[model samples]
Each structure stands twice: as structure tokens, then as C-alpha cells.
Target: MRYDWTPLWRSTIGFDRLFDVLDEVQRTADETYPPYNIERVDENRFQISVALAGFSSYEVALTVEQNVLTLEGRKGEKDEKTFLHRGISTRSFKRQFTLADHVEVKGARFENGLLLIELQREIPEAMKPRRIAITGAGPGKVSQIEAKAA
Candidate 1:
């Protein structure tokens, strides 16, 4: 089914970039050359796995720009060889994931034809909200109320 995104624009402000990114994400998601999966490992950790059967870690490139995570792969050049039929795909592909603020990429490793990307969430202490304690009635309470009511 098709969705109209105009309503989002009319109801919200300062979301132009968000709409642009969402459009890009939808366009790229329709492609089916390479398949991937995103799994939440823990409360503060995540793992992104992509099926890279014929691709190697050297051919894969991982980059983080702004809040977007991008992965690109390029197969090495091969000498021309005569073949009756070719079934496996060797073309390069690119995938991207939009990351939230304060999310960090810990590292990436490849094994058994699977590319695994690890991510961690590091929240700043100052950004976290804290509760303020309410003190008991003080000596100035009576005078404070009388002066205000006056």
C-alpha cells in the first residue's frame, strides 16, 4: 500500500530533514540485491548482520555519516572466463541504516560469510534528567506566606 507523507509535514515543524531521510530510506529498502537483518542484542547493544556469501571483509566498507550508517561492497576484478551459465551475483551493493543520537559504533567483524556490526549506546550523564528533592517546612515559611498574601 502507498502512504501519503504530506500530513506529517503539515503537522510538524523542523522535520524537513527527517522526511528527506525517510524518503531515501524507503527508496533504498525496495532494492533486493543484498539482504540484511538488525537484531537487538541487549538493552544498550545491537547487532546488524548482512548476508555476504561471496564478499570478503576487505571488499566491504563501513562508514558513519552524521546519524546514518552506510555499508558498501565491491568485488575484486576478475579475468574474463568463458562460462556456460552464471548464477551467483557479484555486483557491488550498498546498504544504510539511520541511527539515533548518542548511538555509537563499537566495531565490526566478518566470519563465515556473515558481516556483523556491533553498536553501543553511550548516554551522557549531564543529558540525563534528575529529580530535585523537596525540603521540609523551614523557619521562613510563615513570613514567606504572610508577605506574599499581603
Candidate 2:
């Protein structure tokens, strides 16, 4: 079945660039060569784990540029391998996870052939949603509540 996303653009303003970026990410994320998992740990915490079975710490490189997390793995030729019939493939793989603004990468670790990435939401004060307090017409004009707390 074919799907059209043009209708979504009608009500949106100043979000054309964001939709373009999403399109690119969807196009590039189709190749599931290396499997991954994304899970929410808590209210403001998240984790992303990627399976790097045959890759060692030295063979993989991780980087967080701006809000994009990139994982690059390239396997070098093994000098001591003496395999008669090699079945396990040691191919290069690269994966990218685009992060939202104020979503910070806390830490990353390798354990049990899985690379775990820890993330925490750091919502900025100005970007957070705020609610305006209402009052009686003669008693109080208005009040402002902390937007970040919400």
C-alpha cells in the first residue's frame, strides 16, 4: 500500500526542514544490518543498545556531534586467524541515532557483546511549556508558574 504524507504539511508551519530531516533518517535507517534496541528506563532516562557481536572496543568508534550520535565499526584483518571455512562475517557497520535538543548522552559502555548508551533528558527552561494562571477580574490579574517544573 502507498502512503501520502502531504496532508500533514498543510497544518504545519516552519517545520518543513524538520520533515526533510525525518525523511532522510527514515531512508537511511532502513538497512538493519546491525540490530539495535531503544528503551525508556525511567521518566527522564533512556537507553539504546546495539549488538556488536564480533567487534571489539578497538574496532568501534562512537561520537556525539551536536545532537547526532554516530556509531562506526570497522573490523580489521585478524593476523592470527587460521580458519579453514570462515562463516562469521566481520563487516563494517555504521549506525546513527539523532537526538532531540537538550537530550544529553550520559554515558556509553560495552558489556556482553552489547554496546549500551545511556541518555537523559535535559529540557531547557525556555522551551518547556508553561500554563498561565487565571484569576478573578478584580482580585488578581494573573500569575506565572515555573514552566520547567511542569
Query: What is every candidate's alpha-carbon RMSD to the true fold?
Result: 4.2, 9.5
- Tell me the tens digit of each residue's lDDT in model 1 across 26-86: 7776787677888999998999888888888789899999989999999998849887987
Q: Show pairs that collide, candidate 1.
A: none
Stretches > 4 Å off in candidate 1: 6-25, 79-85, 134-150
Regions of candidate 2 where Cα sits further than 4 Å from its true position: 1-4, 13-22, 79-87, 135-150
Q: For each candidate, how many residue pairs have backbone atoms clashing (under 3 Å)? A: 0, 0
Put down candidate 2 lDDT per residue, 21-120, tens digits, no spaces.
7776667756786888999999889999988888888998999999899999999876596889975667898888888778898998999989999999
Score each candidate by Cα lDDT.
0.85, 0.84
Q: Candidate 2's error at 14, in angstroms?
A: 8.1
Indicate the residue-level lDDT of 147 in model 1: 57
Could you tell me the TM-score of candidate 1?
A: 0.73
TM-score of 2: 0.74
